[model samples]
Target: MSRGSTLAEKIIGRAAGHAVQPGDLAVVAVGMAMSVDSIAPSVIKVMREEFRIPKVADPEKVALFVDHVAPACNVSTAEGQAEVRRFAAEQGIRHLYDVGTGVCHQLMIDRGLARAGEVVLGSDSHSTAYGAIGAFGTGMGATDIALAFATGKTWLRVPETMKVELTGQLPAGVMSKDAILHLIGRLGIDGATYRAVEFYGAEDLTAASRITLCSMTTELGAKAGMIAFPQERLAEFGLPEWLFADPDAGYVHAETIDLAALSPQVSSPDDVDNVSSVDAVVGIHIDQVFLGTCTNGRLEDIHAAARILKGRRVAPHVRMIIIPASDDILKQSVADGSLISLLEAGATVSTPGCGPCIGRHQGVLAAGEACFSTANRNFRGRMGSPEADIYLGSPLTAAATALEGKIADPRNYL
Candidate 1:
């Protein structure tokens, strides 16, 4: 007489006032719906055609952001943003954010738009980033987003749950990003397909660490990602404490990853799951070092890199770029002197946006050049030209590589 476990199940169970079991088809009410400029216009189009409505069911519950193409790169992007702005105004939406606000995922959490235990749907893949703060947030396509806007509800088949318990303390210089890369390496790309990954055990769940871990679940092909919150952690965000899971709660699958022996791990070019330790790739030539993204762009991540690059100048032939996740984080870095250290060490500090991570607007590489990035995804041409090579690693490794003008281990400097 036990209920099945899944992320969609848990959200539907709480939203529908009934305990939902896996494999069940359910219509779940949502607490919030969000979209960025990249996909908001398409969702708006779908809403106009499908619902024939100029407004959403609840405008206040919807959020639109211009973070994806902030500062408006070209005429096309600018027009897209203008359309989103016009739609928000026409629909009377109140939570719309313009440029300079920050990235959508960080802005959503920082602005208190996501509440604990509520179902939130976003149009961006990184929507799972909100799960770090205890909200059940996930991504969908434009059509699904439009339906959610029209009805404040969406249909989902409850997926199974996978329990990932982390035991043992993370060694110094090893971060949550490294931990996740380690998991991807072990599980392969299809490891958690159509399942929810729940992180439990040991380390206190900090906002930064949770974001780092959950943001990369896409690499494992997870449908949704989550972590349990301790009471103190909830209070930090001024939210009510909620129960995560009972001691007797069951999971479809359970696995534990021991991090005591883990070193800095890197997902090599062309494959996210193709992981190797820092020692394996040591001395590889690197042309660039990038430190920013929703995953590793927090103040703590920046400080970790700064600690390693404090007085050392970047290699003359290497290009190092630092982009904070938000304007607030950028300001904090300036106040804490991390910005100065980065600049003094010959690293370029870019605006608070996802630059060079997506290879869209900034830091595209030349043929055969190599880069070590803190962003997620290491697929071919992810950061720039298809011919350019990219490597994914923690901020610490990226910074050390910038110093040596190649892939060097941080322990070398320590």
Candidate 2:
């Protein structure tokens, strides 16, 4: 009799061309290996100096993105991007998305490079974002990516599976960001260490919402985040799914969350696990509101925020910064008047790139000031100024706070 297999086992097993069980060390060929400007230089160096590799196994399968410091803030960064561009051109790589293109995770899916049932890995921790579309997505280091670039395969220890079942529709004004933060709060930071988090209940998740959920599973210390995307959705991309976890598949841990019982939530300064209901922290003053990042910068998020901001202006006391996740999203926002509404609402809209999420070029907070942002990770100095505090919230919360100049509940605005 065939043993019941989890989603992680099925995907890894497929890529390895054999059936695999949990805890098996399998060397599988990757469907796609991704790298960004900050990490690509190291991959290039290792491929050239460490491995002496003559050619990439399949250049088309390896995608390089120039997002994290796009447009090059400093001479060092400019040189790094130049090196990446030169290397890509020399190696006949064709899928390099340059600056102003989009964040790596968003571009991976928007460009049709990532799809359901494929095993994809990137050099950024948020690579798990692709799991929204039902891909097995995880993060790898530069050396690992370089090896994959050279050989087109990487070894992974099959991880135990944890089932996170979603039940009931999300309550009004509650976004996936709140649900993920709530989960992280319950699980603490290391809750899912070395485990694959299989998210069930696709019927309740939009493509964007699923992306938000999977992106933050990394914060729970998950090895990889996965969802069994619906076949009709994958059919749009012509992707096929071979296996899904059986109804009886064994999971090391299982938890079901009722979204209807959840409320809009927030993660306080310096810790993602420091979570509370919006009512608990309402009216706390904020100095800035950042409305975009790889986590929640999609068109859906933008539209949600724009709906809240329409016919209103941001508070004069607060600085509101908006950045679209990608050039395509940016163009869509502009075409649909979302960008115009945001700008007219007194928000400062920047080019399509990671702006203040990593605190590089724009909207750095000042000492003793606080920012409400939709981006993941509220660690000290994550958005510059270790003395500055960051509160993590959804786009709706971000927009409401921008209007009120404080931590405000999005439900009131909705």
Candidate 3:
């Protein structure tokens, strides 16, 4: 059988300065290593023990953020932040984003910490977001990340590629998150395990939406996620154009999806791949609506929600919240009118942070209460009490649900 070129293969190939073949072992070099407060301390301990070095290879190469425990909700979280602060100072890492910065992924991309064709790894699964900028990025465990910190290298088993050909325009009110959810429904949660997904054939996606799509590949258990570099898209980042694949590039698996017919899809509570269209449960009531996360918390996502909620108020029974991905996004939204629109609609706007996504500091849900959110994970008790129900969707769907106080099809409002 002929071998296929996966995105991971291509990236590892370039990083190792060799043409990577399928099943070949490669030692790839990464350009950046990032961690959030939840995982940074553990990685620091591993670096100290395994590397046997008092400090990291390059402190600036490690970017740390406190977004996971932002605003220091309690004494324990405050202590965690203290530990991160002391470690950063001791390691001399200058790119630390403290309480005010935002979600680590958004900050990294917004500040140009990630560049095209470079290998970037993070302790958070949504690290795949950098693929939107034509970079090869993925998430790893804290121990693996710590090893990368010590040696500036990591071993990878080149994975097979899966080509997801997205044809046709997305339906009105349907965004990339819905599209990905629909895919998960068809492929199941473990379908892409240890493989790379390369999205192609959709030419109309904005750079922000493309990143949102790639970021969720982690939910499918993909090794990494990437998109071909369209010149116009690359230009948005002021990045140089690069070829993602040759015309005849091979793929182990290929599937074509016509997105024009897809509806606003939702992943059921607790299981990411248990997807159903909004039509499947049209009148389901929800207690909260959350719009923000590494996946869909970018400026464009907020603008999309604001357009839908501009003249309306959220349903009286629902508590709506909007969290921007970063402080810069928050500042821009304030200047651009989206923030005011959200507030006018009776929605609370939070500072840039992971917030309710991690279930630690903000927007914890009561038992049996349901929420529609834009965050990536919806595991059991991810947002609060074990009995709370969490539905995952795009920011557009989340906003519409807030207005309707139920699982809603955003097309009605759009």
Candidate 4:
């Protein structure tokens, strides 16, 4: 008799072209390996010195994005981006998304490089964002990414699956950010260490929400996170799937989230797991509101903010910054007038890249400032000064906070 396999085991086994079980070490072919501008220079150097590889094994499957510091914040960052561009050009890498494109994860999905049942690796921690479309995407160190570029293969141990079954409907005022923050609060930051999180009963989740959920799994120490069903646009990738777990699939642990009970949630300053409802923390003043990142920078997120900001202006005391995740999303917002609404609300619209998420030049917080952002992490000093505070929330919450200049419930604005 054969043992039942979880979705993680099934996908890893298929990618490895053999049977695999949890904890089994396997070398599997990779569908894609990517890096952003900040990491690509080191990755390319390692590939040149350590491997001495002449050409990449599959240039078509390798990508580099000039997103982390797109449009070059300074001479140093510009030089880094130039090196990445030179390497991509010399190596014949076909999928390089240069300045003005977008974040690496969004570009991977938009270009069809990441798809269901395929394994994708990136140098950034948020590489797991690709899991939103059912790909087994995870972060890799520079050495592993360099090797993947040279050989198109990477090794890994099959991780156990942790089932997170979300039931009931999300309330109108609450968003995916609230649901994920609620989960993190319940499970803690280290709850699913080194395990694949498989989301079930999320049939109501939109593509944007699913992406947001999967992106934050990294904060919970998950190896990867995924929703079980195929995305509506999955067929466009031309990939095969063994995407579902067996009926009797084994999981290391299982958790159920009742979405009906979750309200608008936020991660308070300096800790992602320190979650509380918006009502609990209301009236705490904010200096800025950032409304974009790989975690929540899609068109849907922009529209959500726009719906609340329509015919309204941000508070005089608050500085609101909005950025789109990709060029396509930016164009969509423009075509649909969401961009105008946001701008009319006194929000500053930046380029289609990682804006202030990395604490780079765009909107770095001054000391003692408090920022409400849609980005994933909220550790101390994550957004510039160690003295500044960061609160992580949904776009709805961020927009509402901008209007009120405080920690405000999006429900009131909705």
Cand. 1 Cα-lDDT: 0.82
lDDT of 3 by residue, 177-268 (tens): 88888888888889888888889864478878888888888888887888875545667656555535655667788888898988898888
Best-to-worst lDDT order:
4, 2, 3, 1
- Identify the runs in model 2 with alpha carbons over 4 angstroms from their true place: 230-241
> Which scores higher on lDDT, 3 or 4?
4
Segments of candidate 4 deviating more than 4 angstroms? 230-241
Clashes of each: 0, 0, 0, 0
lDDT of 4 by residue, 1-414 (tens): 477877678778888999898889999999899988988888988998999986789899898898887789899998999898888888888798987788888888888888778889999888878778778999988999999999999999899999999999888888888888998988999988899998887656887898888988888888888877633433543445456677788888999989889889989977899999888899999999998889999999999999899999999989999889999999999999999999999999888899888799689999999999999989999889999999999999998999999989888977
- Point out where model 1 deviates above 4 Å: 3-8, 202-205, 230-242
Q: Which window of ten consecutive residues has the lowest lDDT sum in model 1?
A: 3-12
Sort by TM-score, best first.
4, 2, 3, 1
lDDT tens digits, residue span 1-414, model 2: 566888888888889999888888999989899999999999988987898997899998999999898888999999999998998899999999998998899989889887678789899998888877768888999999999999999999999999988888898898888888898888987899889998877545777888899999899889888876544555564556454677777799988888889998899988888989889999999999998888999998899899899989999998988888999999999999998999899988777777888887778777898999999989999888899999999998888989999999888987
Cα lDDT for residue 94, model 4?
76
- Position 288, candidate 1: lDDT: 88
| 1 against 3, candidate with superior TM-score | 3
lDDT of 1 by residue, 312-357 (tens): 8999998898888888999999999998999999999777777777
Evaluated against the true structure, the overall lDDT of model 2 is 0.87
Q: Which residue pairs overlap in candidate 2's backbone?
A: none
**Candidate 4 — what's its lDDT?**
0.88
- The CA lDDT of each predicted structure is 0.82, 0.87, 0.84, 0.88
